[model samples]
Target: MGITDFFSDVWDTFAHPSPDAEAPKGGSSTETPAAGTPEESSEEAEVNKQDAVKSDESQQEQGHIPSDDAEEEEEEEEETVDPKDKLEADCQESKACAPAKHHYDECAERVMGQIENDGKAKEDCVEEFFHLAHCATQCAAKPLFSQLK
Candidate 1:
């Protein structure tokens, strides 16, 4: 599938969750059955559970299962690392990023200060913020550009 198709499918799944995925909250339903019986509800619950198992099996068959060890390692690493530290590490890894680091830092601080002190909405600063981000991204890709020349 093309990238657009793949993203469309992902968007559809996120926008509309499957009915069997989650139970109705507070036992409320728009359509009440005439019987209103306990046995029927129990049977429906059993069917939902079976459906969930089948869904999981299908995902596994399609090679969608995640590695438990990788997940655990990621959780452990997240607990030990701060977000700012991670961003700094990412910047340090790129030779082009080093020169633009000061500019990016200044832009970030200004944007944050405006949002906090001036009560400006993040959306209001998107244009300026994205410009700074684009500059940094360009700087970070300089090495690759030089190699092509």
Candidate 2:
């Protein structure tokens, strides 16, 4: 049908190979023969086939490729946590959101106070979340964390 197919067909006809003609040494088409006598020698292509088959089999058994699903599950489990853990779990979730959630919450509270209450207050209660987040994260790391209080 194509140039390669036509050439391969003609080559096959001339070689007069039987239907069961064995594949070359490594099962590949390209190999250079080492040394050949006029009557008793195979082409170089066959030796290359042996090398290829050996390499392919080695790769299959050794498994050089890392597992994608396992890595992803490990990362997902990083974010996954228990709801009953409450404060500890919240700390993990806060980290997932970023450390600035408290700072932003404080800013929002100040804005709300400015809108709802007097424009000038002696002191506004600012809820600093970063400070709390840091303290909580540290506390969770301790063995006797409650003693730290």
Candidate 3:
């Protein structure tokens, strides 16, 4: 699984305590950690309750959910140091570029920083610049998406 998934599994494990597999007893505490003192048990319970509250609140917040862009970037970065991840990500149009509300970051920067007469980086920036324009045009209903894929 992914990093978030792995972390989520760990969090689930710690947060939800279930009855022990072999414990069908009537007297022993099967759900809570057994070895802790009374004070520690109370403290742990309190902490868990607080964590639950925090997790629920975060889930309800606006526009904070994980995005494919972030996950892909993390995966690609882990796998390689090539700038092509950046280039490929910069030019994508559909769901790959969805996480960005309006503009892909690098393309935005390149377009905004397009210096005329000084054509040093102009050749390099051409691909992203056109792709950004085409993507925006598609979003505006003129439809340039098919031209890329």
In model 2, which regions exceed 4 Å deviation? 1-44, 57-87, 91-104, 109-129, 143-149
lDDT per residue for candidate 1 within 1-149, as digits (tens), equals 99999999999999997989987679556575556565456678999899999999999898788879868887877454444444445545556554455555666687778889878845354555455556555554655455446
lDDT of 3: 0.60
Clashing pairs in 1: none
Compose the digit string of candidate 2's lDDT tens values, residues 27-103.
Answer: 53334433453332355457777888998878868985447986788777756454335665565455643455656
For model 3, give the 10-residue run with minimal summed lDDT: 140-149
Candidate 1 CA-lDDT value? 0.66
Ranking of all predicted structures according to lDDT, beginning with the best and ending with the worst? 1, 2, 3
Best model per lDDT: 1
Please report, in order, the local distance difference test score of every candidate based on alpha carbons: 0.66, 0.61, 0.60
Native-to-model Cα distance after best TM-score fit, residue 146 in candidate 2, in Å: 11
Looking at candidate 2, the ten consecutive residues that score lowest on lDDT are 32-41
> Each candidate's TM vs. the true structure?
0.27, 0.28, 0.18
